[model samples]
Target: MLGHQLLWPVVAIVVMLVIDVIAVPSFLDLRVQDGHLYGNPVDIVRNSAPVMLVALGMTLVIATRGIDLSVGAVAAIAAAVACTRIVESADEGAASAAILACTTALAACVLLGVWNGFLVSVVGIQPIIATLVLMVAGRGLAMLVTDGQITTPSNDAFSGLATGFVLGLPIAFLIALGMVVLTAVLTRRTALGMLIEAVGINPDASRLAGVRARTITWTVYVFAAVCAGMAGLIIAANTNSVNANSLGLWIELDAILAVVIGGTALTGGRFSLAGTVVGALLISTLVRTIPSIGIPSEANYLFKAFVVILVCLLQSPRARAALRVRGRRAASSKAVAA
Candidate 1:
């Protein structure tokens, strides 16, 4: 079990670091000429920010033994709402477009989260089906928000959230870090996290013990939506433009991959936030190292798939059981021969 906890992400990190170290050969002889890191780490950090946020939520959702297929759609819808408000604000001159964009996105996210919570908890809809409704319609709503036109906000304050940096780090990175700390605090520092775990491990038992399962599930969805909102804001700020159709596209997959690769189980029984963080870093590093070695972008998907396969391969209960059986068989043969 300890081996399972330690191996995959460590291997991934070591491999990535080695590739990055050898990223440029002797002929290339590339070294840092500027005060910055040897590589342009901003893009990787920025792009991975959203995925990390989503995965953090996914870690909770998966812990509940529920899957949220609508996070990508939620992100798109949130961005659409933010951009729509930005465009409207620009026309009316009532407020800065950036402020309006973020506010609207966050508000919409909270409402949508409540909606998801309602369906999944109160209405008893299955998690997948409940979220699927939003998933299918969210992009269309996003198109409606902008009248199918892309929006670019001129406001610097809101854009600064994505673009501005502090103390030599991207602002988005700080935001992601803050959220991670909050998550850790919520789960590890308080009973909130314990309740979530108990509910995830066994809902009926948790309820029998006087825990409110419905409330727990609802809060989880809301939390997931907030994360999605943050992700949307980060992406929108980074680009300074919002394309409803393409913005935050398919990011849900990355989040799930991160959550799973970090050693969190898909079944609602186990979670490890630290593992998820490492998984996110491993993914970003993998993507960054790929092009450095002249590998095609298409290979990245394959590479991630392979890593996920390994995560499942080495840690699966069946694999451990098989190993145990093999060990026992060898012991039995030795004892009989003796």
Candidate 2:
């Protein structure tokens, strides 16, 4: 069933290659330096890594027919908190200031996650309304964390999460990859998978079947918050500075697009993590290719707009049904020919 899901993407890649050969000629070599790889592909992976984490959590939320538009806010707040604390601790004469800062960053993010969890789980507020409060107020919280000052920190090890590497791979990319694999295992192997799907299909039915529907909903939101927090820290690490207003802005939209493009239905009850990765790659590639072909920056966004529309159209029930119907017809024709 999953292999069937991947068919069109595989075909798309082949078509891209054929087009590249005809038009760009040397398009395969997207390198910018002699040995150092650079350009849109690299930039895509770098920028997309943090969002991938957030999108991953969003995918889970969406699977349950819910949304968390506040992840971007949480991410920004996490970044601000991390930056402010790191700078403050250094000023306070801590011996291992960077370590303290790192701990503080992660701790702050977890606290925010807990707060989100409480509001969504314990308070029983609608996920959209509940998360919206934080979305609006979170930047203020971030500003308060730094006393309304932009935070600057000088730390080598702290920045390494975004820039350094244990192997040749970027740490950001590796972390995102690990999350992809982890989600794959979580949804594919455990009873949690069935429970999540059940909840998505019908909450009342799921509850009657002994599934803790509310608990699942709570967990998904918390998980999403944690991922957003982690992504915030990563972005902070990458840039070494934090501005509450600028960080993680409007990222919720991108996550939804990625999930939908990967074949996950917004209506709930279905998700595909592997498909999400391909969707992310597709997004990254499209963004990268625009400038590679000399398109203007404003026009580049237009390209993204079109691809998003195209992917969403392909995921529509009518389109999916058509594909399945065609596949079944092919099978019938083959049998008759035999």
Candidate 3:
């Protein structure tokens, strides 16, 4: 059942790779230097780490019939807070400073998540509207935290999160992989996954069935926020800097797209973690392939949009049925002519 759910995305990613190989002869080339791997595939995964992390959380939120528009803002705020904390630390160069900065950023995200959860589950505001409030104001909040300035904090330990490698793989990718694994274990090995699905499928029914719907909903929101916070840290660490206005800008869209492409229905209920991972990889590969194939950078979004639409259509049962009907009609016409 899992394999069937994931087939489309897995096939899509493999197709993208084949395209990459055709467009760039060296696309598959990999080498080891100084105990670290280097290659386009590695780079694609490394660059995708942040989006992958954000998408992991988005998967759960979407599974619960909730959308978190504020994730990008929350991520920006996390990066801003972390960078500002590092700059303000008495010893910004120390590893301890990095630890403190990370802790502070994630803690702030928790509060933001709680705020979102309260508005949606407690206040009874629609999920979209509740998150939109934060989406619009969270960046301003981030700006205020950074004193309306870009923060570039020099911290080797902090930068290592993005730039460093472990066991011949990028640290950032490893971190994302770990999160995916952890989330899978939590959701699959326990009752949490079923509870989440129950709430998403029908909140009132789940509540009557002895499931804590509100709590489950609230928990997923908080987890989503923390995941965004971690993604923020990775993005900021990549450059050792944070720009309140631009950090994590529009990333929510990418995460949402990834979830959709991963075979997760927008209406909620069933979700595939493995499919989400492949979807993220496919998006990242498309981004890389566009430039490699010499498509103008300005029209990148156009190409991506086209591909996304095509994938969604392909995923639709009605669309597939339409295609099959057309094919049969054409065959009948040919047989009549003969």
Question: How well does model 2 score by local distance difference test?
Answer: 0.76
Clashing pairs in 1: 65-268
Candidate 3: residue 79 lDDT (0-100): 95
Backbone clash tally (model 3): 0
lDDT of 3 by residue, 222-313 (tens): 99999999999999999999998999999999999999988888898988888788778878888888998889999999999988888777
Q: Estimate each model's TM-score.
A: 0.87, 0.84, 0.95
Predicted candidate 2 versus true structure: per-residue lDDT over 171-221, tens digit per residue: 787888898889889889888877888888898899998999988987888
Best by lDDT: 3
Better of 1 and 2 by TM-score: 1
Error of 2 at 89 (Å): 2.3
State which candidate has the highest TM-score. 3
The local distance difference test score of each candidate is: 0.79, 0.76, 0.91
